[model samples]
Target chain A: MDSAISVHGLRKAYADVTAVAGLDLEVRKGEVFALLGPNGAGKTTTVEILEGYRRRDAGEVRVLGEDPGKAGAAWRARVGIVLQGTGEFDELTVAEVVRHFAGFYPTADDPDRVIARVGLTEKARSRTRTLSGGQKRRLDVALGIVGRPELLFLDEPTTGFDPEARREFWELIRDLASAGTTILLTTHYLDEAETLADRVGVIARGELVEVAPPSRLGDRHRAPATVAWRTAEGAVEATESETPTALVAELAARFGGEVPGLTVTRPTLEDVYLRMIGEKA
Target chain B: MIGLAQRQGALEIRQFLRSRESVVFTMAFPVIMILIFASIFTWDITPGVSFTQYFVTGMIATGLMTVGFQSLAIQIPIERDRGVLKRLRGTPMPPWVYFAGKVVMVAAIAVVEIVVLLAVSVGLFGLELPSTVGKWLTFGWVTLLGLTACTLCGIAFSSVSRTARGATATATPVALILQFISGVFFVFTDLPAWMQQVAAVFPLKWMCQGLRSVFLPDAFAAQEPAGSWELGKVALILAAWCAIGLVLCLRTFRWSLDR
Candidate 1:
């Protein structure tokens, strides 16, 4: 598959500090690639460079088959960005803001349909400033997709979303991916990344440490599973195993089936993420 | 490009009109300041020059100041702080189109404020209207040129304000000091020669002097006035300032605060 975004030896430094140091990455077309990192890890810097908002000191970066640094309006039209924050247009209703932004693109989706997709149809007439946090994020997403862009950049898109809202946002992203729009997402929430990302990349200290499928990330699912059960002494015994199903079966036989308070747990993405970040520190 | 510029220009006007507080503050403050100064000094000033004409001239100058200084210094910084500038930076639209749209909107607002104030000064306060149509046209263009200077200067001022709260305070001190030295409140002739020299370096003095020429009679040049208030010179100075301001603003403006 053709790559939507490619970076080679990307290096950006300010004065005496280096933000991105010889970093390399590739995001294939029509894939949701999530970049996870700690604060000051150069995630935002790299994304800004790709968005053409800032010039890099030295790097080779291509977005949507053209060098982003030199791309003009035609290239810009293909890339949609949903930033972490939004502007105040209190006089404008949701429909007005969406339609207004749609004017910037050569070919844009219908404003009403885009609003409906983000589930803001009911609040179409409400002023933007009156919308709740989740609703505002929905509007931002609506504006981002109005252009029918080939590639979308979402920076901490669900930073302020509630549990229910975050889940709904994941659905919206998945639908966009299904429609064949490539996405590059930078987020601090591991669950958000795992839930929506086709593949996850862990970034630490301005370096791409690991990249893999969400379930197989950093031995995340394959790591030792904790198997615990109640013993005859009225206490508990536990053991870590590569094969928890087999261990549970053996325990069931010895305990005559249905062991009391039996529980099987595995290391989650968050567990591995913390360890990776800690090791970098 | 023209089509997009027109559409964006209309939207910018709509956005400005939607915000009741900013519009009110931007238009009303200068008008009120002009009225207060006119009322206080009208009785004390010498004859031959109607305090009304003096007041009208100062009010027009205030209009220029409003559009040029406050619009850029305060409003631009506020908008930038709110992430509006950052959001626009991400779009596919040409940067010039965006700036053109803003300049067009600000010019309109400045014109409306000037017209209303001039109408009230002449119609309500019995101030002398301009003697000829050419004088009126000169008033129109000079105010516009002065406003253009201010808007560009506002863009430059926006770069100095790191936070929105700091923008107003940062701008007011410089504005007041210039107002005093530029003879906006007092006559430049009455001030020290050095003070007059210092005011000449800035555009505000020329803007106010140019407005005075439009409203005052041709015969009034006898009273030790600073040389001729040449229209061509006024236009040239304003255009020069506008060009310099644009270059500086584009060079230094930041989309977001340093992190």
Candidate 2:
């Protein structure tokens, strides 16, 4: 299948600082792709170039088989963007703002349906400025999806959201992905990526260092598991081993059954992410 | 594009009316200034051309300043700073559609201010009426031309403001300076000759002169510049400035202050 996004030798510079160095990326259609990076790591610049909001100094890029640099309004209609900041249209109620933006697209989802999907139905009549931070972010997401875009770009869409709200946002993203929308998401939360992304790419110093499935990224699943248990001495003990199951079995034998606070902890996506970024830096 | 323009125009008008603070500032400031100048300034250029007529003309100019310069400069930059422009940019609406809506709304407000000032002058102040349709036509065209010029200049000024606070600083000084030099603050005849010459280079002077041409009698024009009211030259100059300002605004405008 053709990829949703393709880039090769992409580079961008401003004045004396290089924001995006030569980089290559490809996102297959109908998949959720997460880009992990630190601040000022050229992630935003690269995304802007892909969104046709900025010009690249040198690059080859095609989003959904059309050059983003030359894509017309029709192409823009097929793409959605959830930016990092909120808009304060004080006079516009939630329903009004959503309906207004929905009218711009040729084939828009029902504004009321989109608002309800984003959990803003309760505040539909409330002015946008009066919404809470998470509610405002939901409005931004609602605007992004009103057009029913084929590809959606989300930039830290859950930054200010509470843990519960963040999980709800993850479900929303999953639903969009299941409906065949390709997603390119950028976020600092590793758990969000692990929960939502099919594949994740790590970027550092304007370069892509790694790309793989969330479970397989950076040998995380294969990394030695830490086996911990409370001993008869009333203290904890631990050991890193490739055979965690055997260790647990031996501990079970000594404990005459369920190992005391027995836990085999594996390296999480965050642990692998920090190690990769630390090494790359 | 027209549909988007209509929608945005309606939204802007609604928003402007709802914001009591901005409505008071933009709509009320010019009328209050008119009252202040009419009460404080006693001199007139000629015996027949009363300060009342001059106050009405100055008020019209002040109304243009409020709608064209103050409204766009303050509102546009603040919207951009707040990410309103950026969010709009992501939408499928054409960029020009947003500007078209802004211009239309500003023009409507300018027209209302002009009408109010004219009523105040004719009904209360007893200013002389235009004797001919040609003179009234000239008045309409001049106001249109001046509104166009100010609208374009206002968009251009929006680029200089990165934040809401800086918006006033960016646009207000230019408006005040032009008004002062164009005889909105005081009688132009009282200023030094060099100051009048400098003011002549700006659109404000032609706009004020054009207002006087429509309201004051023909004999008054003979005593002023160019011997008689040159409606053609005023239109051409104002159109040229409008073109230049529009080009600058479109080419240099940024959706985000960071850009």
Candidate 3:
């Protein structure tokens, strides 16, 4: 199937709270899709439903061509999940845990190679509890991919990583994506979405508000630019312009050489994201 | 499925053994308790049977409870809270395989605990070993049934506590009180009538009584409340508990606390 994940009018509620209210989504084969939202905006709830960890109250859902809630172990073999804070085998070494998980799949990757891919080869012999937080998260990734799954789910995989570690993790995800794995990633980092996702979906108030490539999300490419420059009086002058290049050219001609402190910028992904989520920017 | 279960069992044992504190505490607690109780209670129960002999059987039953019931009850919740069970549930491994692995680990630990307790009883307390194949067979079946019942019950009971500390607070008292009423720390016949009835409802009392039939002298059966070993009733009650425990496990067991 061309679509690795497909959902139609999915709905889920927790007691009195509506977590996912009639949300619909799809991820095609061999594409990286990121789900971005604020906390309590149904990001995790929606991901958990798609992961088969939670049931939807209404609507049809399919992952790898089967209903996750009713899918058997064979279906499970095709999906890999790296949940938040899940690599917690305190007494077992990294290799031991990864090797153990490898036995569950019919076609599994080499546990040692999976470890190295996650940048945890040095810590393979170390007990999981002894590893740093970033290393432990890498182990989580190792276990998630050991089964050679066609579709992988990573929920806030780099929540607590340092900048360097996050970069390394993005590289590993890129490698997986290039190898033809469909990825559904939920991240709070807008830059992560911009960097990794082929298309990012923004969920707000239990519904998907927008879904598009990060570069064009919310018609961001066509949004007016904010052109700012300093006047001779040492005061900042700014105006919204649909044609920033023409505005800058006019300002430069008036100044007879260059506009002082000139800056022209379109809305960033974060700005569009903030506006989509109804947060002031 | 069997292959996965076996691998899981091996991994469970490896993890258990690597945790030195749990190893020392789970196995040694029963051995130490048997030693202390055997020494302090030196009086004879009947004309020939000594209190040490009677107490050793009760301690064996207690060891089975500690390893199968108390330890599993406490450990499972810790693992649940740690996301271990949740992580496993995400895999292709069936749920039954996880429990089968637990059973294997519990049985292995119980075997080692039984050996150590028996050695202490035979060497230090002069407790007699079973003489015939029949008595040895009785010991074997009782150990199996008792451990299975306790393990299943522990897995079911783990669902009641949301955290490991809560499990310890809850399981320890239930275990300690059962030991007191079920003759693990005192004589069965000497216990209060109402207490005896209460203990009978649970599996530990029957486990102790069944074990007594194997370890205590045949003549000591007269001192039992039923005036005999009541092997049939012992087997029946334990088997019933096994059924009840299995049903509870199937109904109540959770892969994570939130679920």
Candidate 4:
């Protein structure tokens, strides 16, 4: 009952194809959960069903404690959704679009403050069509959060952002999460999931493959670590070790202190995600 | 909800005004057509009714049909393709409010069209204004009903196409053909028997007849197909169309691309 989202035996199909099949998942309140999958992996379909934008063929799906399929305006008001891309409203300025969406919810954030929070303060009066791809993505986020909803859904939010913009966006999302907004986002970007999500859920073929904290995905922390270093002759060497700490100490003693470029690295989230999806496929 | 729809309507109006081609076509072109047709026709439909007056009323019908049905039919599908409707669906506002906003804008355009067309007819062409309270009331009800029917029909018809170009293409053929057969561009009586019979089934024909009933003198009603302006039938047909359109719009409107 405390969960922000819950689904059991969920199923959806279009004509001859099933999009989400017998999926089960739960997102707890005030937690940032990232749903990860590749293209055509039913991530969008599942998110849309949870967002109440589409009906599932069969399921007991509850978002904010209401069945999204039968939820009304009050239920919708408690949920904020940033869809994949809402690139229209070309004639509206940033402030205008944000304010317009703010009108829909009973409790809303200040549109100007929301725009400023998204780092679009200077572009408030600029028409939406003139915004860069990254700026548009920011605008989407601003509008999504303007409702001050109890739950928010972000679908591939930083898809076209530059590295810096993506980082800033991650900071903005982190700020929202810190304010106790339950957020569920979908992304193919494993790094983004690692930085932003408190827990990451991997989905494939309309099923939940794994759900765990980012550091624990693919048993990454428990997996063997690679102890790597540069030798005095400028040659590099690395070796898999169960105890990278012991290995680092041994290397430091052999060099009589400060082994060159000494480091212990674990598998990246990308490596773990790819291996998981690859194994499923 | 109404307040939000009004804001949305005002936004649509601003966007409409910003588009030079749409402003020229949706608002100005009708006035231009009125000037061209009124200037070219110098005869009377009967003894006292000048072709200019008849053309004026018919052009009023043309203006409503264009704004209420043709332009909206085009805009809605384009909005859908642009993900505007989909985005609105995500908001707390009811999806129907989006179309309500559109209806407000289109209805406002239809009203402006009537005013401008009437101004041209009265100020330049010396057409007589309706003198009685009854005639004015008739004008009021018919215009409201006609705009509702046409705009609702436009929203319903938008579901016929998935793309903007397809909507425009679909709306144009039907609207233009109705214009020709229902007396928008010429005398309704002069059309071929088959064309007149075909036009009778649609609401635009009743809309045209209803406008003529309000604007034309009582004697001019003699020229109508039933030898009368048939105001009662006009109201009935347009009301029926409004009911039918509401049903279809509820059934066919799409809030998002797909599941």
Give candidate 4's fnat, 2 decimals: 0.76
Over 4 Å off in model 3, which ranges?
A279-281
DockQ, Cα level, model 2: 0.68
What clash pairs does model 3 have?
none
**Candidate 2 regions with alpha-carbon error over 4 angstroms:** A255-258, B42-45
Docking verdict class for candidate 1: medium
Against the true two-chain complex, what DockQ does each candidate achieve? 0.62, 0.68, 0.76, 0.68
Between candidates 3 and 4, the lDDT winner: 3
Query: Which candidate number maximizes DockQ?
Result: 3
Candidate 1 Cα outliers beyond 4 Å, as residue runs = B257-259
lDDT of 4 by residue, A1-281 (tens): 78999999999999988888899999999999999998888999999999887888998998998999889889988888899977468878999889888989899999999999999999999988899998998999898899998999999999899999998999988998999999999998888898899999999888899999999998998999999899889999999999988888888899999899887888999989999889878
TM-score on B-chain, cand. 2? 0.94
**lDDT of candidate 3 over B147-220, digit per residue (tens):** 99999899989998989899999999999999999998888889999999999999999999999999888988
Residue-level lDDT of model 3, residues A123-142, one tens digit each, is 88999889988888888888
User: Model 2, B25: alpha-carbon shift in Å?
Assistant: 1.7
Q: Write the per-residue lDDT of candidate 1 for residues A156-222, one digit (tens) a residue.
A: 9998888988888889999999999999999999988988999988888878888898898897866
Writing each residue's lDDT as its tens digit, candidate 1 over B1-259 gives 8888887778778878888887887787767776676677666345667666665676678667776687678877787888777777677877787778878788778778877887777775666778899888888788877887888888888889788889999887888788888877777688898998898777888788788888777766544354577678778988899899889888987776733
Local lDDT at B119 for model 3: 92
